[model samples]
Target: MKADVRLMVTADGSHTAINQTLDKTYHSVHGAFQESQRVYIELGLLAAFEKFPTEELCVFEMGFGTGLNALLTAREANSFQRKVIYTAIDANPMAVEDAKQLNFDDLLATDYLLKLHECPWNLPVEITPWFTLTKQESKLQDWQTNERFHLIYYDAFAPTAQPELWEPEIFTQLAHLLLPGGMLTTYCSKSYVQRNMRAAGLSVEKHPGPPHKRDILRALKMG
Candidate 1:
């Protein structure tokens, strides 16, 4: 909410959160956006998507920061000829004009950046014949959708910054929204987060983290 949260270009010309509290960036100092693409998009979502049938993939993202994950997913779906119904929730929606000013176009290429803005808000907008995006400018806790998702990207802020969002009750609710055998991937590997996932009826696993991160959490809903 603070205007002080300006995007900083990292050493590798990637954008990242410049935390006012710590006076540091939230992601890697080397390549902020590049690290996110590798960790969340490639190792997390894309890897999970590859395991399942690609005809129709339902994806839900918790924090749609900069729409990086969403844009990457769209590009992948288009390339693979996979149909995707992407639902993303963000409490504080960024201004489209401001987003346009960011270096996302430099990172993801110009054409994809344009398509990202073209994807409608609060309604399903077709990106391709097979890929559609439905964005919600609301808190994840308040989101109520009957559509069961096959994959979830839990990219909330650190628990320390926003503890309420990481509570067990939230995870329980998310579990109910996932289809059986669906997977949830997160950058957090905290024990409390793992416990919450288990409480929500998911089988949890730990995987090697991307670059600087030590570990990451992946939970699967088993019927």
Candidate 2:
């Protein structure tokens, strides 16, 4: 979104985008690939499968900055023989055109990174037989969806970088959009953030985080 955007190599040899304007990066600098798989795919999506026991799931992703979570979720859904409807919203997807340069293809064994970005926004585009992605360039605060999500990938910038995004009022609004038994996963386990989720009427719990981080959060909406 700006001339100051740059691609960075993370610990797991995958790439992440840094926005100099916001002083924030899309993924964890510690290890983008590891962080993405653990926080979103392995933890978030799988939890939904356990709770829902369905072959199909709808996901609402807070940030589609790098499409790393989208890619991994697609892969996981394929492996699990499930259909994933991924709705990713990003206010301004930074370095998206340049995101093709990331080393994720080699790591993921799929060259669909550019395909993920080039797909038209505001419409569902089939990225694979098992995955359909719909990108929405809308801010989370202003986002309204008629569809409820079974899983939520809350991959926004850190609370410190964008405090408003982590506010309790925002989570309270998001809580109404979750299907019963749905859950949300995020790499942030800050006490305040957990409090926000709890305040929104979600059951919050702490889980082990990826490398270099102590804890992550998984909040569930019971049926």
Candidate 3:
């Protein structure tokens, strides 16, 4: 899927990609940085760390879109002084040129986002001493990996835009990728979405969402 995207300033003065092909915005219009920090970092990453404090944190992200989640995760790894191995896959990644147009460097006062975009795909690149990134050019359905992750950032497009991605089969595949007690977080909390996760053998929870959103989801794989 080749995505035709245009950079736009979100409500928080951060940059987001508007997918013209799918008629969807990569991040919330209310605030791109706010949503990523709240849903992925605060709720997802922090919770995962508390759940598996002594273990090496391995993360698998379904959609790498603008690399915002990875950027945030890298920063968290540095602050927590924990090593994080992050693997992210996207069928249609934003062009590096377009990624350069983002304002995350300005917001973060760091050049991490630039490194994330410039890193080679299909190989692990150490973004920091505490963080390593592996970007893959693949789709969720097509990806095959023996690695299991402690946390999953399901930052795919909305179900309305990509219904196939939210299917029960997809959740089942994701469930199998998680280690015991592993967690999957998404910015969606629809009834069917929760049901699908449950049917895939995950215990689901509804958490408070970011601004302009009501609720999000965090599903766990219980032994």
Candidate 4:
């Protein structure tokens, strides 16, 4: 799917969003990087990682996008003395060339865009002794794995743009892939999405959103 990618600023002026050409699936009226950091990295992934305090943590990310979340998490993992097996699934993988054009390097302290470009497609590559990245050039529905994730970053497009992904069946599959007490976090706080999360056997909660958003959703697998 060809998308028209354009840059837009977020409310916080901390990150930029790349709007899709054909549809708003990749459209982020809010800053993409900033939102990812606030919702997923800081509040979601990092919080969960700290709570568990594991030597090695496994993470699953739905929309690789600009690889912002993955990079930020990698930096955190390195500082915390934890190993991260970060797996990301993107149906429409961005060309390494296109990703280089983004301002991720300028925004993030680490050279994450380079690392993202360096990661081989369809295979796992180690960025550091503690940080491994696997980029799957496939749709989430089509991908299957035996590895259970300790945390899931549901960064897919909006439900309106990608309705199928928001269904209960999808969440059910994700829930199954998670270890007990595993947590899932997304910027979406839609009622239907939360309801589906519960239907999929996850315990759902609503949390205050980042600067622009009103609320976000978080789900956890019950032991």
Candidate 5:
């Protein structure tokens, strides 16, 4: 792990990293893998698959973090035999060595986690026949891409920790990146966050969250 980032075990016996500088963990303390599965996969990716059944799925993730979400998503793509083009951006990406500290292999029973971290950044790498990953080392505000997406994983820090990221203008920009009928899922469900989604012209819905969290948000771009 980096000097400021340390690994911790969550309630589900899965690994998560704590950013000492931000005073925040990359995932919920309740369960890292569980949270990713519920919020990003079940809510975000699976919902997109159902909504746009036959199309090759395109996904944009705001915070790549430990690549837990990508790992899970790749697993699903392989399982479902669906093609996924995943692009993820982070202002400060964790080192591959640091990512190795997370025991995703033990949790998912696959070595793809290490492959996800070690893959070259800023270029798409085929992790599996069904999954392609393009990692960008840039902030969401500065990221430039011509691609629109079917789903977005908005796993950013809490609003209290990074309030500017949760603003209406940011949500508006994110909304524009989504394809019609596309959606975004995040761990945050604060009233102001939902209001911001609505302000961004998305239809927001509240869903049951994973352990330790009461609710999560899913905002869709209505065609």
Candidate 6:
């Protein structure tokens, strides 16, 4: 389960939200931006870019909490002159006004942050010439999409807090969303979660994680 009820700052001055219901934080306690950069950007996106080398890529993200992943991704797409079709799904998104209070002003442009939260759900909106975003207000189980993705950022809450989401069936569903050779990366490296990913037909690997986190999971679909 996810919570968008309260805002908190991580040790590195990045913003995160605490889910009182699940007793979890949206990002790593050590650093939110750092975690996103390592788990999703470095390992997930950049890795996929090498495997699927193209000027354009499609990405699907779970747990769009705070739009941190999307923001970082958009910046990369613009900076590198690449195109990104970013589709993010969040079951219960925090109110846009409340999200504005988070401490992302220094890391992101104010207008970009505002548009990220204010954009209409279910419709793809162009955030920049290179980045197009489609925010979906639906649960992973309930959401449907015809488009397959080259990268999937599996950034949901920890398996301990949301065990159901870390199940084999959930990973199997994610595998179906990926193109052959696509990868799913997360900051979680639990053995059970790796087993579930393998059971879902992904070849799993563990990579060094950012501060405080020891290992991250990266699972790939077969071509």
Order of the predicted models by lDDT, top scorer first? 3, 5, 2, 6, 4, 1
Tens digits of lDDT, candidate 4, 56-126: 78999998876778888888878876888999988876666666666666766677667876678878998
Residue range 1-223, candidate 3, lDDT tens digits: 5568998898999989999999999999899999999889988899998999998899999999999999999988998998999999999988888887899988987678989989999999999999999999998999999999999999989999999999999999999999999999999999999999999999999899999999998999999
Tell me each candidate's TM-score.
0.88, 0.96, 0.98, 0.92, 0.97, 0.95
Give the TM-score (vs. native) of candidate 6. Answer: 0.95
Off by over 4 Å in 4: 1-4, 14-22, 25-27
Q: Which candidate is the best by lDDT?
A: 3
> Which runs of model 3 end up more than 4 angstroms from their true locations?
none
**Superior by lDDT: candidate 1 or candidate 6:** 6
lDDT of 2 by residue, 156-209 (tens): 889778899999999998899898888899999999999999999999988999
- What range of 10 consecutive residues in model 2 has the weakest lDDT sum? 1-10
Over 1-223, each residue of candidate 6 has an lDDT whose tens digit, in order, gives 3344788889888999887777789998899999999999999887776777664799999988888898889888887778899999998887787788887757666358778989998899999998999998888889887989999999888878778898999999999999888889998898899999999999999999999998998999997
lDDT of 6 at 92: 80
lDDT of 1 by residue, 100-142 (tens): 6667667666456556654677999887776788888788878
Per-model C-alpha RMSD: 2.6, 1.3, 0.9, 1.9, 1.4, 1.7
Q: On a 0 to 1 TM-score scale, where does candidate 3 land against the true structure?
A: 0.98
Mark the regions of model 1 whose C-alpha exceeds 4 Å error after superposition: 1-4, 18-30
lDDT of each: 0.76, 0.87, 0.93, 0.79, 0.92, 0.87
Candidate 1 has a TM-score of 0.88
Better of 2 and 3 by TM-score: 3
Candidate 5 lDDT, 20-138, residue by residue in tens: 88989999999998999999999998888898899999999998999999999999999999999999998878888798788988879877998998999888999999999999888
